[model samples]
Target: MVKQPAPDTTRRSEKSRRAIYDAALALVGEVGYPKTTIEGIAARAGVGKQTIYRWWSSKAEVLMEAFLDLGEQSAREAGQESYAFPDTGDLAADLKAVLRATVDELRDPRFEVPSRALAAEGVVNEQLGRELVAKLLEPSLQLYVDRLRTAQDTGEVRQDIDPRIALELFVSPLAQRWLQHTGPIDHTYTDTLVDYALYGLAPR
Candidate 1:
């Protein structure tokens, strides 16, 4: 008979931590943020509630980490760096590629379900909303600003354009469609956004 090596504490702890993240995401997705408690996450994760308390100060903290981890995992599985926005010199093409990917991600059940729950809750919870923007959204947005700045230096974008606000012209519309269900999101839609954003409505 072959004997198996005893599972070490680090391995066991890591397994428990992954379980906690999965449980927190699924619970919030299924039962909204307000109803997702540490005890519930513990029960779902099959760990003691004290284990959660030891790691996180609150459910908000746990959920935030879980969402961040989920984004990183998705990026890894997709074979891309998390939020490393593409800058291939052709600014419009780069923006279109990134936005198309965003469209796919926004439509994915695994991301959309939990994100919708958190986004809705954030609207009411000022602190949670601020943290969500600070911890996740703003970092990604800054990438766009950086790219736009590079475009400005290259003379692709106008020199006086505020990269931060200019980015919102394309980014915000897509986000609105996803969050508000105002319209369908797809590669074509995002491509159109990039075109319209880069070229004005005025005729040549």
Candidate 2:
């Protein structure tokens, strides 16, 4: 029978995990995903290969979790929960606030480069793409779903609207802009998106 690691041992392991995440993000940003190896990450992180292998199966898995952790840290620094949505009673206000934060995050170098590497890889790698969408992207999107549902209940959103599709009207546009360099993302742009999506651009 194998005994669990001691508390100090666990703390040290966590420290190593953080170091590995930092190393993975940095290496991916500098070298891109194709050249990023578990061995390279371990060497840069000052840990053994077995340590990383014990925690994660592959470089892709390590980088995926690393990016997720990085996003969560950035969100926390921005005074927002990584997995929760802000509901300020006013739909437009809440969406604009959240999207403004997203714009800031997209511009952050620490978040931007690594995310680009991962997103680029996802576009070409089908399995990793699905895994990333399911594990990392969908969970974040569900927060929007929950918020939109609440807005519908309170009459701030149309009752017949599909929260998933409706939320994407604003969300996916920003994502596309950031991913493809399609346009500038800013507070004003996102604010306008909320207005257009909610009030309709045809006449109202």
Q: What C-alpha lDDT do the candidate models reach, one value each?
A: 0.89, 0.87
Regions more than 4 Å wrong, model 1: 1-9
Q: Estimate the overall C-alpha local distance difference test score of candidate 2.
A: 0.87
Number of clashes recorded per candidate:
0, 0
What's the lDDT for residue 199 in model 2? 92
CA-only RMSD, every prediction: 5.9, 2.9
Candidate 2 deviant stretches above 4 angstroms: 1-9
lDDT of 2 by residue, 1-204 (tens): 112335667777889989999999999888887899999999999999998887788898888888878888987887767766787898888889888888998899988998899889889989989988987889888888999999989998888999999988899899999999999899999998899999988984
Clashing pairs in 1: none
Tell me the tens digit of each residue's lDDT in model 1 across 107-199.
Answer: 889899999999999999999999999887998899999999999999999998999999998899999998889998899998998898899
Worst 10 residues of 1 by lDDT: 1-10
Q: Can you give the TM-score per candidate against the true fold? A: 0.93, 0.92
